[model samples]
Structure formats: C-alpha cells, structure tokens
Target: MSLLDFDADQLAAFAAEVRQDYDVLKDKDLKLDLTRGKPAAEQLDLADALLELPGKGNHHAADGTDVRNYGNLAGLADVRGIWAELLGVELEQIYAGDSSSLNIMFDLVSWAYAFGTNDSERPWKDEETVKWICPVPGYDRHFTITEKFGFEMISVPMLEDGPDLNAIQELVKDPQVKGMWVVPVFSNPTGVTTSEEIARGLAEMETAAPDFRIVWDNAYAVHTLTDEFPPVHDVLGFAEAAGNPNRFWYLTSTSKITHAGAGVSFFASSVDNLDWYKSVASVRGIGPNKVNQLAHARYFGDADGVREVMRKHADILAPKFTKVLEILEERLGQYEVARWTEPKGGYFISLDVIDGTASRVVELAKEAGIALTGAGSSFPLKQDPNNRNIRLAPSLPPVAEVTAAMDGVATCVLLAAVEKLGA
Candidate 1:
C-alpha cells in the first residue's frame, strides 16, 4: 500500500517499529560506505599489469620518441590514437596528460579566467558578473570547480535526454554566462546520456557571449554497465557546421578504466582552442607523464582492448548496482514513497524520496553506521530545492556490502517518511 494510505495511529505504530529496527541496526556495528564511485580492490586488480607494464626495453613511444625524455607535450601519439577511435575525434585534436582529468578541467577554467579562450574579447575575470550553467542533480565536483572560480552558477534540470537545453540556450543569452559543464555520456550521478538531438542543438544554439564554451566531461565513455551504451556523436562536426567550432572542449580520462590515480587524461578540442590551451599549458612543463601513457598504450594495444577491460569492469559493477536496486525495490516499492533511476551504464542511480525527507534519511543512515552521499550533493552548491533527490554510488563496495547498505538506507527512508507524515 502507498504510504499515504496509513492513518495517524498506523503511521505512529509503524514509525515506532521502524525506530526499533533502526536501533537494532545501530547495535550491529556495520561500517559500510556508499559514498563515492571508487573502484573496488578486485576491480583495480584488473589493471595490475600496468604496474610492470611496457615491461623492460619497451620504453619507446609508437613514433619512436623516447618516452622517458621531456617534450611531446601532446602526450604519447598512440595513446591519443586509442582514445581517438573511442571518442570519434582525430588524433591531432586530442591531448593526453596525467591521471586526473579533473585537473585538466580546473586548469581550463582557471586559464580561461586569466588568459581567456580563443574567442574571448577579454579574460573571464574581467566580466562584471561571470556566470555558468549547472545541470541539477549533476556532478558536485564539476560544480565545485566553477564555483571556486566565483562564477554565478545557474541550475537547470537534468532530464534523461540531458540538461534542459532549452533552459541552457536561454541562460547563455546573457553575456556573463561564460560556459557550461556537461557530462554528455552517462552523466555523473544520473547516468543519462545526452541525446544526439540535444548535442546538435547545443552545437547550433545562439549565445550572447562569443567565447561561450561547453566543457564536456565524458568521464564514463567506456564505463558502461550494460549493452545500451550510446556513443556521444559528432559534436565537433555539428559545432563546425553551426559555425561555432570553438564551442566545446572535451575532457576524458582512464582513471575509472584502469588505476584511479595512474591512468592517462585527455582533452579534445578545435584547432584554435587547442592552440590556445597549449600556449597557456606550455609554461607548466615540457610534457605530461608519458611513462603512464606509454604504459596504457602498451597495456590496451588499441581501442578494442580498452572495451574488453571495460566489459570485465561491468562484470564486477553490474552486480553491486543490481543488488542495490533489488533491495530498494523490495523494501520501498509497495509504499510508493520513492522513485529512482535504473541506469544502464553509469556509476550512479539517482534516487528520489518523498519531499522534505531526504536529509532525514541520510542522517538516519549515518546513525545506523551506513554512509551515503549527502542528500543535496546532486544540486549546485549542494542545495536540493525540493529536498528529494539522492545520488546512490553503488560502485565502491562489494556486492554483499551493497546489499547491506541499501537495506539500511531503505529503512531510514521509511523512518524519515513516517516521522514527516506523523503516522
């Protein structure tokens, strides 16, 4: 029955029962975390070969450049080629760096503020009011980078097709709205890939700022958990066709694919944007970690090898995600007190509970020794206006632990609902 069907006395009795159940949970001393999309140990084990990789005497890059030496700032040529086949970009458009693409993102925004991008009339910091669009229930880290730059963040709804492009187009009509952060494929915390239609629209849309950019973080491009994974299509072609070749700068990494801190990062863009980025990046160093990139190229061999490893990851992750979903359904389905996204390919399942109860649910989970992503993390500045959305990261824990964590979480959801309804 729906939670609304219960009368005051029933709710009170049910709430009391839930309280007792929670007390039992607290005493159990469980220490489980469902807080981040970190890979499990065994998952990390899949890339163990990278440790001794390029093995002895295989230190030369594909083009015969000594990878151990400085220079080749664009990174190993073959490494870029591997990602080129996957991202559908020409190799010249791609630049590989060290492990964290998040670093690349921060650098881009930071440099753009000081030196400005190719089309900018002046540095972003010079603007009277710098603004950016953030898709709600989106990646918190993405929001943090832009927010740290002091940009006025405008939150728009992130639908299954992607961020509300209509809202984004309208927002960019203001010259101060300098850019947007996007995860075009298998977006963070939602797993919804932006449709080709949306991608095309973004490429063609009019903006008041000539330097407006789309910082596309396709982090989950190969992190598919199922077969329905959609490739992010021809964004560059569409942008060029729309006469806005400078509109998007794409960032990606193999952090989740291989060792989290040891994989290579990539940034792809138009020639002009890339040239500008290189000019600003030249002072940082002569090159990135080519040793890591060389290790990756030797490990994967090609695009096909990358996909094979991802399939192994799916074998490990698919079950944990399934267990979490099964528990959520079995516990909360009958009550109709919640709804959630069953993602085909990303690291998270976005859950929504009855209004005003999300923070209470998270608090209850914590008291029972289970940790979850904070309730409002999906929104810009961690504020969920409706207090409903919850991002469940089922990727880190083992399958059995995921089952336990979700059970605790479901109970907390019920307890919070009962308290709020007062029956």
Candidate 2:
C-alpha cells in the first residue's frame, strides 16, 4: 500500500518514524559514496595481467607492423579484429584509438562543427542554429559535450526500449537538428536496450538535416550482469540498407573491460565518414597509442578473451547491483513513493522519487554522509522537470557499502516524501 493512502494520523506517525531513522542514519557517521559507475577494485584486478602485457621487446603486431613506431592511424589489425567481432562490425569499419572513446566522440562533434561531415553542405559552426536531440535521463557527459559546443538540446523521454522515436522523428524534421546521442545497449542509469524495432526506426527515419548523425556510444556493450551478452545490432549496416550509410557513428571502448584509463577505444562508421574523420585526424596527430593498442591486443588474444574478462567483471558487479536493488525494495517497496530500474546489465539504477522530493532526498542522504549522484543528474542540463529522478551507481562500491548507502537513501526518500506530503 502507498503511504499516500494512509490517513492523516497514520501519515504523521510514519513521518515521525522516518525522521527517527534519518536521525539515526546521520548519527551513524557513514561515509559511503554511490556517485560514478566506475569499476570496483576487484573488477580492476581481473585485468592486472595487462600491466605487464606485450612483454618487453615484443613490439610487432600480427601483420608485422612495428607498434613501437607511429602511423597505423587505423590501429592494429588484431586489436581491431577482436573489437570488430565484439561490436558486430567488419574489421575494415573499426578504428582502434587511444584509451578514451569519449575523446573520439568529442573529436567527431568538434570536427563536424569545424569542417562539417561528409554529407554536410556547410560546417556546423557556420549554421544559424545547431540543435541536438538528447534523450532525457541520458548520459551527462554527452550533454556536456553538446552544451560546450552551444548546441540547443531538445529533450525526449527514454522509453523501455529506447529513446522516444516519435519525438525524435519530429525533432529531426528541422535541418538545425544536427545529431543525437544514444547508448543503444544497456543505456546509462535505465539500462534500456534499444530494441531492433527502435534501432531500425532510428536508422530509417528521415531528417531534414543532410548531415544528421547519431553518436552511438556503446560504452556498456559487453558489460552484462547476466551470463549471456546482449545482442550488438548492426546499426551501421541498418543505415546502409536504409540508404543513409553515413547516419551512424558507432563507438565502444575497453575502458571497463581492462583499465579504465588505459584501455583501447574504437570508432566504426561508413567508408566516407571514416575517410572524412581520417582527413582531419591525420592533421591533428600522427597516430594513436599503437603500443598501448598492442598491449591490449596481446592482453586479450581474441574476442572470447574479452568476453571471459567481462564475465569476471560480472561476477564482481552482479552482487553489488543485487544488494542495492534488494535494499531499495526492502526499505521503500511498501511506500509506493518511488520506482527504480532492475537493470540486467550496465552500471546504474534509475530511481524516480516523489514528484518533487528528489533533491530533498539527496540532501538528506548527504547530511547523513552518504553521497549520491546529484538530483536530476540523468537529465539534460541537470534538470528533471518533475525534480524526481536519481541515478544510483552500485558498480564502484562493495556490496556491504552499497547496502548501507541504499538503506540510508531509502530513509532519506521516505523522510523527503513525508515532509512533502505535509505530514
């Protein structure tokens, strides 16, 4: 039963009880953090062998290219082949880069702003207005990138399958809407994988902008909580079949698979798009870190090697995620004042509190020394219209810490809801 269904006196009594719990939480002096979806220490340990990988004086790739020297702007074939198999792209379509896929994403947008895309009639910087479609409760860093470039961000709700395609289809009718960002599989916070129907819609949809692009950031492509890996859609191929070969910019990284800071990044796209990217990228630098690519290539001898590593990551992470979800249900299930995702994969659980109490809940949690991702963090511009959503990250903390943090968080949510109800 919902706390809303309780009588005035019942509500008041519940409020008092929750207040007591909150006070006790504060008194416990807990210093727990549930902020970022970073891999835990244990998860990192699984890839420790990479620290001494490719051994000393072993500097050649399978093709006998000297990895010690620069100029494989495309990266090692073995490395690209491994990721190509994993990401469902052809070997020729993928470009393995340095550690950060975010860097590659930023460069794509920046390059478009400066030089336009392969299909662009003019540079985005020269446009009268550059608008972007951002799925709400989406990735903050993605929004930050567009925000920095001064693109007008249009928000659309994220559905169980993916971003609201109806809304997106309408938004793209204007030529100013240059692009959109999508995580595709096990999206951030919500863990809503884009179904094939939605993926096809995104691929087949018509847009007024000749250079409209989709930055498909598959950051968690292989980060599954289950034994089975999620399907990797052939989005680039979908676009090609839809006669929009240049519509998608596919990206993925081994950041979570290996070392977050030192893993390899990948970019795959149409031949024209790749040509366009290389034209400018070559001017910027001689090549990516081929030696590090060699290390990662040597570390994961094949695609299955990457999957085995992820399975180990799953073993470490699944328990922490389970604990958080269980605690959320045990503590807040009866009240019906909140809802959260039970993600099978990905690093976050999207929690929606009472219509306007999310900020209050976060504040109460902070006062009790439990740090959470800020309120409305999952939305564009850090603004959730209802002030209701919170992203809970359980991947970084240990299971016990996740339990404590989530329990404390539940108390905060109850307290905030009761106070908002005038109890």
Which model scores highest in lDDT? 2
Best by TM-score: 2
| Model 2 spans with C-alpha error above 4 angstroms | none
lDDT score for candidate 1 against the true structure: 0.90
Task: Look at candidate 1 and tell me the lDDT of residue 26.
Answer: 89
TM-score of 2: 0.99
Question: At residue 384, what lDDT does model 1 achieve?
Answer: 95
lDDT tens digits, residue span 182-261, model 2: 99889998999999999999999999998999999999999999899999999999999999999999999999888898
**Candidate 1 wrongly placed segments (more than 4 Å):** none
TM-score of each: 0.98, 0.99
